[model samples]
Target: MLMEKVAEILREASAEAVEPRFRALASGEVMEKAPGEVVTVADREAEAIISRRLRELLPVPVVGEEAVSADPALARALLSEPAAWLVDPVDGTSNFVAGHPDFAVMASLVRAGRTVAAWIWQPTTGTAYAAELGAGAWRNDSPLSRAGAGGDPEKWRGVLKTRFLDPATQHRLQTGARVFGEVTPGRSAAGMEYPMITDDELDFILYWRTLPWDHSPGGLLVTEAGGVCARLDGTPYQPEPPGGPDGLLVAADPATWERVRGALA
Candidate 1:
């Protein structure tokens, strides 16, 4: 119920700040956050709106991707809180800048280092995915479940971001694709992966970074939809900062997780 409310808020904010600018971004509307990272006016405006609304609804600290980027201390402040909100106003900023359709607005409620609720909204199609830990995941109010077992490693399909790894690690994984089945590079769209996993279009997703605003919400959505979510070290997942010791690896089920981990090992 709380997540649904959050989703509604995101939907409204996204419609206002995100949708209208989809393919209409002006020359100066886009700015560089980093060499490869980008930010658009839409991202900033939507995040500001969501941050204010979320704070009003819960009166808790809010950590948004754009807000934290502007003020690093805000990130630490939110993480130190017993309960706080994590918002990725526009998860796939790159795609959004490129006018791609694979983008989402996501938020998660992290209580004492654990995600208790998650909501993700796909603005283009208006599809929403929501979950409360232990209550199960849902797609637009319908109960959701992941696909059945993948047949073989050689045939398994998943999203893999080897580019995020060190060069040696990337080369090793690339040359040893036999053990990995099929690993496609994703669009870096945070919440988009879980929908693919839930629909059986993807078997797993391995990301080399674990930003809470990017992965936490989707991680719980996968776990509640009958998937296995953990770090590469096999610990239960929590929202990790910009650089953590391990990355996020999620599979459609426990068995698939072990299979993929064993392959990596």
Candidate 2:
């Protein structure tokens, strides 16, 4: 029931605060929150709606991306609180601002430093992706699982997102990634990438940064779908206990994860 409720909240937030502003963002609606990190009016508005609804639904700390940007300390709640909600109102703010269909609204329920449930709502496709820790993953009402056979690392297709890494690390990753048969700097959207992984559109994705809101929901979704979402060192990815190694690798399955990690990490 909670999964269904959160799914509804995600849809509501997207409908009420995201879809209408898809490409209609005004001059002041978009702004750079950090040097290259962008946020939009839709992000703030949708976050507010999602956070409020989340609090009412579970009364936990709602640590949203926008809220954390406003007050970084709010992020600590993910470590200290017994349970909390992680929200990324616009997972692809840049895409949304560019009128691209790759953006999504995402949220995850974290308890004792672990993600237990998650939801991703893509307004453009009118699709809701969800997962409960042990209940498995879904696309709308249908179950979702990794759909392809794993192959040699050299024949794998995936993306390498190294923007957040240091120059040296980036170069190393870029060099190491040559082993893959097909690699591209992916669309900077975890919400979209995770779904693609589950659907077998890609074999793996290597991320240099693992912001909780950005990765938690999709991490759980991928894992629940019989894929693997973990830190580069093979540690389980958790929302709490913030600040760890910089790499995250999500793949179609365990073997794919190991192969990718061997090549990149």
Candidate 3:
């Protein structure tokens, strides 16, 4: 029932605050929160709706991307708290601003530094992805699972976000990844990428920044779907209350993760 409730909250936020503003945002409604990072009025409004609803559900700290952007201390509180809600009101603000259909509203319930439940709602398609820590992962009414072996390291296809990496590190990764089948900078949305992994559309994604709102939900979804999500150093991906420790690698399975990690290393 809690999962269903969170899913409803995502849908409500999208309906009440997101969809109406898509492609219709005024000049002032979209602005950069930081260099190369954008946020929209929909991001704020939808976050408000989701955060309020989440507090009513558990009275826990509501750590949203916009909220933390406004107050960075909340991120530390999220790490210290016994539980909290992590939200990305609009996962692909740039896409949404440009009238693209890939934006999503995502949220995750974290307990003791681990994600316990998560939801990602694609407003355009009205599709929802949900996962519980040990239960499983689902796309709408269909169960999601890893179905096949990732055959060859050289044949693996994936996304590696290298924009945030330093020049030296970026060059190393780009040059080292030459052996992979096909590599591209992803669509800039973890919400979409996680689903693609579960659905077998991609073999892996290695991200250099591990922001809680950007990854917590997707991490759980990938793992629950029988995939693997870990840091570049092979530790399980854990949300840093203050947010750092780069390099998150998520793949279709453990073998693929190792193969991909080696190719890039």
Candidate 4:
């Protein structure tokens, strides 16, 4: 399966890329990208290595964060391609540049607009999560099952989703349920942990932005892990839809999904 090989490559590349960069930053290197965004040399180097490795393995096209423009037309065309890899070589680049250990390498194989395989590697923690269509999800070598056994939010330990809530939204959630909100160390790791925490007995997770490379792989992991992922509006996730918005909402159990959806509403 694509996930296994991809995971192997990711683990290797992430270690090779992040270790040195982390060291450089420790030695005094300012990291900055856009005016407000931050990036380190590690981001560019990691993307190069990941891009090379992916090209060698599959020889298919890739749309990566550092290289891709925000052109909707190009994104749509790439997603519609029969075979393409969406790569986020260093998700949470801001965190990595800032010496935070919450960044990750993320990739997804999209076919006909649907993610068929996915991989996410947390470089600092040496954790790799992957999944293939119908094959199930795995963290390292261990398999991941759904949270709560049968969509029971109460039985779950934690849940993850979006965090774009306003003050009113937060207040509503507090009034209805006792759910706790946790911000993961990095976006990529947080994305992977969305499904993983459920496997760990967590109740739910919420996220706001859904970058192609970030959520595609993470969403597949949850689905394979026996969980459900969707948009905030309860719509199924479609990476390569002919025309649609770019965002994601996820939950370990259906009950939690509905519960969180209501709070957002």
Candidate 5:
């Protein structure tokens, strides 16, 4: 029920605020947040809408990507809350900014640093994904198969956000990437790529960044679907802000994660 309402919030907010602005920005609809990051009218307006609805759903604190970017202190403060909701108003903003169909709206509930529930909605195609703690993940209403249940991992197909990597690593990985399975990076959108893990399209995934809003939802979905999630060092991943222990490794299973780690290590 909570997830259904969460999905409803994402769907309605996207339609109302995000979709309308897709490739339709006004004079001041988009602005740069950082050198490479951005915030759009769609992102701010959609987060406002979702923040209101999610607060209505539960009285706990709401930590949105845009809101936290404006208020730096919120990031450190959220980790201490008993419960909080993480919202990514318009993930894949660069893609959305470019009119690519990869942006998504996401929400996740974290109780004392543990992700209890998550929802990722792609408004462009009306497709959605949901998962709750200890329960199976679903696409719409159908149950998703556990990892490796769909197909073989020949060469071990996975997602690696190579663009965000160091120049040397990026060049090495992208140029001679034939050795590594040509994974489709999320392009700053976990909601778009995480669903692929559930369907077993991706055998594993590797991400070096530790942004909470980006990983919280997708990580929960992968584990709920019977996959493995951890950092490169084989430690458990806790949902939190950046500036701490980073790196993420989610795979079809523990063995696959280890194999990939060993190969890359």
Candidate 6:
């Protein structure tokens, strides 16, 4: 119930939100948060739209990256509420500020410390990915179906994985039989390094990160897509962690997940 309704709201808001900012990026005002962190008027405006819409759709309290206390302790305390919403109005702010389309508007519903549902919308691309606790994941209007095993690795495509790796790790990946592409920084790029496979091309995607807003929606998307999601360390992701760190690893298919995990390990 919450998942379907929330997904619908996100898709509707995304349609209204994506274009204005997509066009404004070049002329958009920019600001700095830290050495590698940046924000823009577009980010703030988008957050406002998402927050307002979410508030209207669900009465629960929301904790967003830009609107909440930055301290991990404070964030943990605030998110520890029995039922709450986690939002990343723009999950890839750096990409957005740089005029890239890889950014996303993400949201998740957390109940009793567990994420029950999630939504990730790529505004620029007009793609919506969503999922719920027991319901399967979906993209646009289609339910995600599982891919059967095949002899050719080229034929073995399914839900993809995305990760942020340093140059060394990138090199390791190149030595393997896996096929991948470097995600271009700007433009509404979904599926980046790991993409959801449908019709022989990457489409739907769920990015994993420690940011509750980012991963919560993505996790739900994977689960609803009939896939599994977890941290690289294979731990259940919690929006409110005892300590704060944002690293995550996710796979769309269970078999693919096992192979990727084994390779990484």
lDDT of each: 0.85, 0.88, 0.89, 0.67, 0.82, 0.58
> For candidate 3, lDDT tens digit of each residue in 1-265?
9999999999998999999988788878889999988988899999999999999998999999999998999998567899989999999888998898888899999999899999999988888999999999999968898864458767778898998788999889988888888889998788888888998888899898888998999999999999989988899987776457888999998888888888788
Which model scores highest in TM-score? 3
Against the true structure, candidate 1 reaches a TM-score of 0.95
Cα RMSD for predicted model 5: 2.1
Q: Please provide, for model 4 over 1-265, each residue's C-alpha lDDT reduced to its tens digit, 9 standing for 90 to 100.
A: 4566788888787778777776467543554545766666666677778878888888877777766633445465455568877887777776676667777888888888788888888767777788888988888879888754344334434433325457775566445444334423224455446545445545455555566776788788887886778887778776752234644556666766676566545
List candidate 6 stretches off by more than 4 Å.
1-5, 8-18, 26-28, 69-74, 77-79, 148-209, 241-247
lDDT of each residue in 124-158, candidate 6, tens digit only:
67777666677666777677664533333454433
Query: Which residue pairs come into collision in candidate 2?
Result: none
Error (Å) of candidate 4 at residue 217 is 1.0
Candidate 2 lDDT: 0.88
RMSD of each: 1.4, 1.4, 1.2, 3.6, 2.1, 4.4
Please state the error at residue 35 of candidate 3 in Å: 1.8
lDDT of 1: 0.85
Error of 1 at 129 (Å): 0.3
lDDT of 3 at 35: 94
TM-score of structure candidate 5: 0.92
lDDT string for model 5 (110-200, tens) is: 9988999999998887889988988888898888767453333356677777656788887664554355555666556788878877876
For all predicted structures, in order, the TM-scores are 0.95, 0.95, 0.97, 0.81, 0.92, 0.74
lDDT of 6 at 121: 71
Q: What is the lDDT of residue 215 in candidate 6?
A: 59
Candidate 3 backbone collisions, by pair? none
